[model samples]
Target: MIKSKKLMYQIIAVISLGLAIFGVITPGFPATEFVLLCAWSSAKGSPKIHHFLHANRFTGPVLNDWRNGKVISLNNKIFSSISMLLCVCFLFYSGLNIYFIGFGLFGISISFIWVWSRPSHV
Candidate 1:
């Protein structure tokens, strides 16, 4: 059963890995999401791509920490903080805002909290 699950993860990882790369040149694609998904899959399945990701000095610690069941880190928190600030500033300046924009903000805050709330051994 575990093996089957790992295989599923591997397939998904490959697809996400492809999408991540493709997103680099695609206007409507979000490269980060796919890359994160690929990282998740590789971490869970022990794939070669996981090793590649882990070998990166920047991304390795975070991915490895996630694989080890740690939730968040200072780096992610700072990134999220900066993102939130930028998004809020953009919303204020662009005037393309709507009532539901708060919901989006709320969601971002929630994700930040959820990911960073737990302590990691890494």
Candidate 2:
């Protein structure tokens, strides 16, 4: 049972890490949240991966800040807000449906507020 659980965790960590990497390259996808999930799963499954993520220069500070406190850097906040706004604009122009547009706007608004509410990393 323990071994299976560890394997499951490792699988989840790897998948989350892959998505996180993709998110870094993609415009709208959020990477930080996926990295946090990867780190959490790795901690349970593989110490090696956990240590590496913690030590990594690019992702280390982000993971550390988020783990220690729910902090998002000012730059990240700005970028995410802009990206979300752009997405909302696109959704509005898409003309899928009034209900869909309203739902999308509502969700985006909530996400925008949550992201901005987090403490900005200094």
| TM-score of each model, paired residue for residue | 0.61, 0.82
Per-candidate Cα RMSD to the true structure, in Å, reads 5.0, 2.0
Off by over 4 Å in 1: 1-11, 14-36, 43-46, 69-71, 120-122
- For residues 9-100, write the lDDT of model 1, one tens digit per residue: 99988899799677655532344457679898888986698888779775677666666775557765666566666666666666665765
Instruction: Highest lDDT: give the candidate number.
Output: 2
Candidate 1 global CA lDDT score: 0.69
The per-model lDDT (C-alpha) reads: 0.69, 0.86
lDDT tens readout by residue for model 2, 1-122: 99999999999999999999997787556777788899999999989889989999978988878877888888878988777777887887797889988888888888788888899964
Worst 10 residues of 1 by lDDT: 24-33
Sequence-dependent TM-score of model 2: 0.82
Which residue pairs in model 2 clash with each other?
A: none
In model 1, state the lDDT of residue 88: 66
